[model samples]
Target: MPPNLALEIKCRESERQALLSFKQSLVYRYDILSSWTTQAKANDDCCNWIGVGCSNNITGGDYHITRLDLHNTGLMGEIGSSLTQLSHLTYLDLSSNEFDQIFLEDVASLINLNYLNLSYNMLRGPIPQSLGQLSNLEYLNLQFNFLEGEVSEVHFSKLKNLKALDLSDNFLRNCTLGPYFPRWLRTQNFSVLDIAGNMISDKIPRWFWNNLSPNLLFLDVSYNFIKGKIPNLSLKFKTMPVIILGVNEFEGTIPPFLFGAQNLDLSGNKFSDISSLCEVNYSSPLYLLDICGNQIFGHLPRCWNRMLNLASLSLAYNYFSGKIPHSLSNLTRLKSLNLRKNHFSGEFPSWFNFTDLIVLDVVDNNFSGNLPSWIGLRLPNLVRLLLKSNNFHGNLPLSLCNLRRIEVLDISQNYNISGTIPTCIYKFDALTKTLNASEVPDYLKDLVMMWKGKETLIHGRNLQLQRSIDLSCNRLTGEIPNKITELVGLVVLNLSRNELTGQIPYNIGQLQSLDFLDPSRNNLCGENQDRLIVQDLLFAISSGFIIGFWGIFGSLLLFKRWRLAYFKFLRNIIEKPL
Candidate 1:
């Protein structure tokens, strides 16, 4: 071989060795990628490799790896410093993997990384301040992990090109706004930002809204302890924004201008009157509006129809009253409507129509009259129907059985309705659990009995019983249903405070899952002394039986003549009912 030919061969081999070194570094840095064997790397194909993207060079020499994504691969080792060798890498995603505390320092070396996601991992310690070096980064997601640190303004003020930032679900504590929560962030082209589920408390800095650029499209600060009134910001952005400020301690009325947002969620706040919202025109392309779990009062805003593009509306746990607006049906795209735990009084609106409706929760309201048969027929896609604690009269709608996909159906507190529950309810494949209908009307007494039953006396594990039924505190009369034993999943039975008579069914013992039993305050007579003794013994063993002795002695004394003596003593003080 000539010297020139030998030199050319040596140069080619040097380039090949460099490429091999880079590939080996990637495998060593991430534990999951280490599985790629030396044989697999020998293949002359770069495009077919897993989790790597390669683009052909304009000179047609070789393909260069442009992207590397190894998300959720259970990689349980410290990120090695060798990753910095991937100089051509533009994208790196090591999200949802376990890493040690100091890995962030090594990650900071990836200066060219534009898209970096390290979310949902067990990485701990303060976010390395060196992250500020990534000036080219556009998208950064570090959510749902145990990353703890004080996210100061200095830490985030440097990422000028960042468009999306998610740091939710972290142990970040005592975070105070540093000269306005990275106010420089507004100057950049950020569209989506999520900083929820942190210990961030303090009045929402005014600079957040004042400096917010119209280019901002999505903002989420939910599940933080933020307090103070929501800021009223002037709209300057051409596109409507989606804002979520739920699960905070925010007080005062919601800013009416917020209605202009496309997706606004102010739920779980201390707001009182949202009537100011009626003044705002909802002509914007709003999609979701959630103000649930607040002190919001006043009637349903008739202007709701203005938001024709609305898809989900939740105003539950408020003091709203009067009829639900039939105008709501105008939201043809509506899929979810939750107005539970309000004072709204009126019959179910006949005009409520939406073929795409999936969730309808109007529970615990003052709504009266019969259950609309057409509700089930109209909302065939309904998944959750909660109409409990209302004044609804009439029998249970048999048409409700038609909802094959319904997962949760709660309509327990309407006293005006008479007759048995539709047995077809048991046939729904999606019905995984059902609350006892009898417990709602007389909830206080039934709750006490339920509490007593949970006392450790039953000594059984995973006992299956009949459906809990509480028909107490009503006009219900007649012997206790013997068929109750057929409901093998029942856990509680309360027939107290009614005109129920006749001996207690002996088959009641057949309900092995019957943890709670309350038949007091009724006309039911007769006593199974042996059964009562066993129940007392079980209760004693489970709960240390502090009161069982007193109960048994009191019952025996009453049976003897204590009641007659008490009556005589009362007769001496007052005139007898002769």
Candidate 2:
């Protein structure tokens, strides 16, 4: 045998071994890889697909699979141990799929792996300790899964190079760090850390914030059972873009440092006093500040002029009182302003101008006087206007018709206006559906019926872009307009609590797109028990004819009484004839 022939044979054998190893690495546990056949593999150009990566150069011209990403592909089945054959694999992403009981013991074999993502899946069971063997791993994301078990220091302390970690939206229980924070986590300079929506219960350790890297910018620990006073930061970083600690059982006054931060969201908590926020230097560029659903009390900070770049301001469901500052008009860039369910009192701010405002929700406030007519005209971009349960007066602003982009307008319970609804109000082409007015005149009722016959009402059917109107409590009187049926895109119609007296047009039932309909507490009387019914027969009888019928019946009864008296008189006269 020649030496060259023997060498060729050896080379062929090595190639065969490489191919077999590559095929084995593709298989997983629970027969999951059975559906991923060779034909399907060929469709992806021999595994050089979008979600797969290889390191052929490092493995001496052999295909060394490194990365496997199968996110959002509707994949199902348990992970297989065959995946361990890819010793050089580094990155693996299987998020937003249906993988259940994801075995992790086999993952420890991939010693050279770096990034791993398994979020938004049905994976369950305790995390494997073998995961710590990945010494060079950097990022690990396992959010939005059903994995349960106590998260111990042993599970995380081994990953020394982890820079970005997200274990949010899980059922992990009892995540208490005894006295001090994990020393291994403190060593790594993580920039993004999210452990939100978990069952972790314990006082937020001080060392957790103290040891955070100066470069940390985003930190989310929300939706947990963690309680205790919020730690005060050293203010070392120049910019902390996002800090979300909402939906927790945290109690105590919010630290003053929160007001100075750029994006502070401490909503859904038990903070009692936020007046300290008013003292924060507003020189910083704070874009979003949401502190809704808290026990905070005190007047809104009048220093709103300093937050020039503020975009969203939500302080709803609080005990805040005092006149809404007219200075809020200075927040010209404001897009959303929600101060609903608060104890705010005083006249509606005349200078309140939100040119860029998309959502202006001030419902359930102690506001008085006519709604600002300029609200619709000035804020053309307004999408939702909820001013219910207030002391607003005057007729519906005709200028509100200028809100061509308005989708929702709920102003029920403000019972101080009296007048026929203007016919021109229906001209808002952008109007999808409106609330029943409290004081509908006869003419407006007729107009509504007329509009219902138009064919152009079927334009906007999508719920996202549809418009709806609600006018449940008013002094409107007249037959319900059939034209209301013309609003083919109407999703909700609430005309309850009005003095409207008339028959509800049968055509109203024709509104196929109507999802909600309420006409309660109205004078409407009709055959439809759910609708108001008007007495057409009573209206048809003329006044002269009704008077004639009463006169005839009275004459008949009088004649009978006279006959009895005459008979008695005759009897007395005959007896005295002598």
Candidate models: Cα lDDT each: 0.62, 0.63
Task: Please provide, for model 2 over 27-123, each residue's C-alpha lDDT reduced to its tens digit, 9 standing for 90 to 100.
Answer: 3434433433343223333344445565556556655567777777766766776566667678888888777857788877778888888888878
For model 1 the TM-score comes to 0.69
Where is model 1 poorest over a 10-residue stretch in terms of lDDT? 439-448
Candidate 1 lDDT tens digits, 1-578: 76553222111223334334545433233454443334434343333445766554679654556577878776555565555656556798878666544367767887888998988777777787788888888998886565664676566677888888887655443342322334455555678888665445767667666756677788887766788887666664566898888888899977777777888988898888776656665475778888889987778777776788888888888889999887777899987787877899989888877888767778678998887878778888775566756887666677877776654454545656554445565444443334423211110111111223342221111111212344333434456655444444444444445445676666666432232234464565555646854865574475444335443455333332233234334444654455
Tell me the deviation in Å of residue 109 in model 2.
2.8
Return the top candidate by TM-score: 2
Model 2 stretches with alpha carbons more than 4 Å out? 1-66, 70-76, 171-188, 236-240, 256-263, 276-283, 433-467, 476-483, 502-506, 511-521, 525-527, 530-578
- The whole-model C-alpha lDDT of candidate 2 against the native structure comes to 0.63
10 residues in a row with least lDDT, candidate 2: 443-452
